[model samples]
Target: MAAALAAAAAAAAHHHRLSSSSPAARTRVVHHHHRRRRSSSLSFSAPASSHGCPRGARALRRAAAGDGGGNGSGGVSTGTVDPAAASSPSSSLEELYRSCATWTWRGMRVNYLVRGEGPPLLLVHGFGASVGHWRRNIGVLSESYTVYAIDLLGFGASDKPPGFSYTMETWAELILDFLDEVVRRPTVLVGNSVGSLACVIAAADSSRDLVRGLVLLNCSGGMNNKAIVDDWRIKLLLPLLWLIDFLLKQRRIASALFERVKDRSNLKDILLSVYGNKDAVDDELVEIIRGPADGEGALDAFVSTVTGPPGPSPIALMPAVAARSPVLVLWGDRDPFTPIDGPVGRYFSALPSELPNVTLHMLEGVGHCPHDDRPDLVHAKLLPWLDTLPSTTALTPVSSPAA
Candidate 1:
C-alpha cells in the first residue's frame, strides 16, 4: 500500500539521522545578534507563493498560479463575527480588525489584539500579512484560549521604521522578547510561512522556554529569498531575482512597482491564484493587505525585505525546538511559494515520523494560506492539538544557552 511505502521511507530517513550525529542534531542556533549571517552567493527570491509584496515573488506567483489552476474546495464557516449582518458580509468583516491594543517594542508602537482569558496563544502572520489575516479564526479561537495576534513591527499597524534591518532573527528576537516582557507566561506560538520560521528560530534560540507548543502553518524555507540555493527552482529564478533586486534599489521604480502590486485588483488575483478556496478572497482581506502599504516606510520595508539577507532556515532550527516543545504542522498541499512537494515541505512531511514530538497534517485541497483558506480544517486539527498540551506558567530554558 502507499501508506506502507511512506512509512518505510520515513523509517529509512529516521535511521539515517540516527546513524550520524545528524546535522539537525548538531546544529545549535544562537541569538541573531551574535549569529546574524546572510546568504552571499545566491540572491535567491522568496517563495512566490507567500501572501504578497516583494515584487519578484509576486510576479513568480502569478506565473505559477496561472500554470496551476485553483479548485473550489473550501472549508465550512465555523462562525461569523456578526450573524445579523450576514447578507451584507462587509458589515460583519468590519467588526474583525477593530479594538486593537498597542505594546511598545524597542521604542516603537507594535499593534496587537487580545481576547479570551485562558491559556495564551500568540499568532504570527507571514510576510506582507498582518493580524487582520486571522479575522476568521480570531473570534472562534478566542472563545476557548486567550489569543494574541501581533503585526510583527514592520507590517500592519506596527512601526515601519524606514531603513531598519528586517531579518528572521530580528523577528525571532521580537517574539522571544514579547514573550518575556508582554505575555510573561508560557504561550503557544502559531505562525505561517516566514512567521512560522521566526517562531522556530525563537523557540530554538531563546534563553527561556516561554513557548509551550508550536502550530506551524506551511513554514517557509528562509526569511527572505535565500534558502536551499541548490534547488533547481532557485537556479532557474536566479536571473529574475537579480533583475528584481536591481530594480528595487531604484526608489522611483520600487515605489511604482509597490503601487502596482498593492492594488486591490492585483491582490485579489494573487490571492485567488494561491487560494484553493476562491470564495475566501473577500474585499476586507484585500484591504487588510492593502491598507499597510500606505504607511510611511512601507515601501522601504518591502524593498529591503525582498533584497535583504535570507536568515536561518527552519530545516536547521527545528531539531532543537522539537526536542523541547511539541510541534504541530498543518500544510496546505496546494501552496505554490513553498509547495508541498518542495524541499521545505518535504522535510517537514518526513519530520513527524523522525521525531515523535512533531505532527503534520496535509490539509486536503488547501492552498498556501491554510489558516484563512480553510479555517474549519485548520481549527479541526489545531484546536484538538492545543488542548492536549500541558499548561505551564514558568520561564524555563528551551535550549542550552551556549550555542
Candidate 2:
C-alpha cells in the first residue's frame, strides 16, 4: 500500500508541473508572444496590455510614461506642455517683428509691423527709413483697417543680403509678395517720398490685384522744379553732397550728420525713438542699418535710385494706375521734397486731362511725411474714401490704359 501511494504521489507531482508549464497556463503568454512579434517585425498595432489588466490601467501606464508620473492625465500634461501654446499673442507678434519674412524675388528680408482688424492697408516709408518711421500712423490706421507698415529691406530691421540691388521694381515685387502672402487681401497702398514712387510702379502693374487704391503723400515723380528753388542750400552744398551721401551711408555717421541739423536734439531723439527706443536700440539694429549703408551693394542701390535709369516717370504711371484704381494724391503744402509752389494745375494737366475718379487733397502745414506729420489730416481724407467702398468688394478700377 505504501509503494502504491508513493507512485501515485509522484504521478500527481508530474501532472502539476505539466499544467503550470503549458502555454495556456502561463499568465502572460499572449503578451510575451505579441512583444516578440512586435520586436521582430514592423507593425503599427496598438500595444497589448499585461494579462488581467483593465483598459483604464493600460491608459494610466501610458500616461505615466509620457508625463513622468506627475499628473498623468495624458491630455497635454503641464509637465509636457508645448512651448508655442504657452506663449502669449503679444510675444508672438514680437517674434514676428524680430524675424521678418523674406521674399526670394529680391534678396531682401522686408520687416513689417501688422496691427488691428479690418480691411488691409499698406504703409510704405520714405528713403533711408524703416517701418518704425510710421510709428505715429500705425495705431490710428489700425483702428479702421488692418495696417501693415513695412521696412523696405535695406532700410529697417531687415536682412540686407549682399549682391542684391535695391530698385523700385525689386522693392515693388517685395511689396507684392507681402500683400499676397502676409496680408492675404487686396490693399490700399499709402506711400511717402520714394515709397510713393514704388507704390505707383506696383499699382501700374496689372498682374497684381492686391493694390486696390493709392494715397500718395507728398507725391513724387512729378515736376519738382520748386525743390530747386527752395533747396538753394542743398545746391550750395552740392560739392559736398557726394561726401555727405557717403557719410550718411553709415548709421553712426548718419546719426552724427543729423547732429548738425538746426533741431538736432529733437531730430536725434525722434530718429532714436523710431529706429530703436531707448531700451531696444542696441548693436544689432546698428549693424543691420550699417550693412546696407556702408556696403558696396547698398551704395550701388542708393546711387542707382538717386541717379539711376529712369523708368516711365511717375506722370506716366499715374494714368495707368488711375485707369485701374482711383488715385488720391495727398500733398503736404509744405512738402520739402516736392514743393507746392510750382503750377500744380499744369502738372495735373500733363497727365490724362481728366480722371473722374481721381481726387487731390492738399494738407496744410505738413511736410514730406504727411501721414506722420498730420495723421488727423490723413485720417480726414482716408476714412471718407474707405467708407465709399463696398464692404465685401475692394475698390479696384476695371479700366485699362492703352500701351
TM-score for all predictions? 0.76, 0.56
Q: Which regions of candidate 1 fall more than 4 Å away from where they truly are?
A: 1-96, 394-403
Index of the highest-TM-score prediction: 1
Clashing pairs in 2: none
- What C-alpha lDDT, on a 0 to 100 scale, does residue 388 get in candidate 2? 55
The digit string of per-residue lDDT tens for model 2 on 131-151 reads 655654665555556777777
Query: CA lDDT of 313 in candidate 2?
Result: 57
Model 1, range 133-250, lDDT digits (tens) per residue? 8886776667566778888978998878766768878889778877776676899999998899899999998666688989899888886545757667767766656666676676
The number of clashing residue pairs in each candidate reads 2, 0
Give the least accurate 10-residue stretch of model 2, judged by summed lDDT: 29-38
Model 1, residue 69: C-alpha shift (Å): 30
- Model 2's alpha-carbon lDDT is 0.49
Error of 1 at 296 (Å): 0.8
